[model samples]
Target: MATQTAAERREDARQRYNAYVATCPSRKLLDTLSDKWVSLALTALAGGPLRYSELARTIAGVSQKMLTQTLRTMERDGLVSRAVTPSVPVRVDYRLTPLGEDLMPLLEAIKRWAEIHMEDVEAAREAYDRCSDSEP
Candidate 1:
């Protein structure tokens, strides 16, 4: 057997990936958006640009550190853009990039689904807890 070149190996891996596969690259993206902070941040940005404090305020219960981390990751992924204005008191803002805007509708659907199913989700959680408590 012959050793495959790096490019050939990459192409083979790419061909093998399907979203349904556990090792698919897309899984990492899904994981990123699965974080509560990341989804909420994207949802908040869907409205328009907002400063750090504004996002923090709009997303209830998100800590400053976590919010900052989420924003950094989104920015790195090209999902959001950060602008820092030079001034005596510098102003920094974040907004969805074109790519992010393109992805927003699907994410919005996920958000809405959660909202529509909140009662069902809560009931399921309660039932699970009750059953677990009864376990030996």
Candidate 2:
């Protein structure tokens, strides 16, 4: 039997969690990232830390329950930090952590790509529907 170095163990663990594998833990993270609420919240916080009410207002159409749930999930995943301030009304603020900051560029790029290509996507969808209608 041979002892593995720390780097080797880390690399082994990384290799084990392939997203393409059905049981890989990275799939869970991928699911989180694909969520609309998560993307919106992360991008909203990119400017700076936002109070809970501000976040709620910034992300219109998100119900209070969903917003709270999304924030809690992000916090648990170490993507965001929550701070509590003692005052007349206890204030809670959310800001992205270093790990979350590192993830921003990828999410931002995805957002940009989506915005840029949406018109093309819509045209494709319309063409597909027209073909389907003609075939039927």
Candidate 3:
């Protein structure tokens, strides 16, 4: 048999992973997706490129520091790209890279699902709290 290429070997290894396992590498990707800021930021950039201030505005309630942190992490993961335009005081823009855009649909769907079920979630939380308080 012919030797497997590096890409093929990596793909084969990835195919063997089960995210349900605690030590699986796929767990890291799940953890990243679990971040609220990441999902919001990705959804905002889903439309197109945006400036730092614009992203902050679009994703209401996100503090500057938090937005910076989120954007940096996204960029680090190859999900977003930051561009600086040297004009006047210098303008910076953030946009979803192709990979980020590819993930937008799923993110948007998840956001919608959360919004639609928020009332049910709140009710569940209240019920859970009542049950816990009564037990202890």
Candidate 4:
């Protein structure tokens, strides 16, 4: 078999990337949004702007470092905005941007689906647990 040329390899990579993006556009977005801290942060900000400490308090089980990183990533993606106040204490606030607002309905739908199907999910989990217990 003949070896592929550099141009051919590049084209192949591009095609594969395009295919992956087309099939899983929401996968990437979901990966980001599904993160516990990110989801909680978005939910909290759904109401309005909040200070960093306020977010930290609202989102239980999130470490300060993880919250900071999640906020930074969201801000970089243009999903959230950060405002800084020039004061003696240097206050900072975070709020959802229009792009982030667009995700609200999607999140709400997911929440609804989860609520509706929770019993089914629980039953599946219990069945899996029983099968696993029986196997081993």
lDDT of each: 0.94, 0.97, 0.91, 0.87
> Which is better, 1 or 3, measured by TM-score?
3
- Write the residue-wise lDDT of candidate 4 on 15-133 in tens digits: 76562575855557667888877877888899999999999999888999999999998998789999999997999999999999998888767777888999999999999999999
**Number of the top-ranking candidate, with lDDT as the measure:** 2
- Candidate 1 has what TM-score? 0.81
Per residue, candidate 2 scores C-alpha lDDT tens digits across 15-122 of 998999999989999999999999999999999999999999999999999999999999999999999999989999999999999999999999999999999999
lDDT of 3: 0.91
Clashing residue pairs, backbone N/CA/C < 3 A, model 2: none
CA lDDT for candidate 4: 0.87
Instruction: Mark the 10 consecutive residues where model 3 has the least summed lDDT.
Output: 12-21
Compose the digit string of candidate 1's lDDT tens values, residues 4-121: 9999999987788667798788888888988889999999999999999899999999999999999999998899999999986898999999999998999999999999999999
List candidate 3 segments past 4 Å from native: 1-11, 15-17, 21-23
Clashing pairs in 3: none
lDDT of 3 by residue, 1-136 (tens): 8899999989988777779889897788788878999999999888889999899999989999999999998998989999999998899999999988888888899999999999999999999999999995
Higher-ranked by TM-score: 2 or 3: 2
Error of 4 at 35 (Å): 1.8
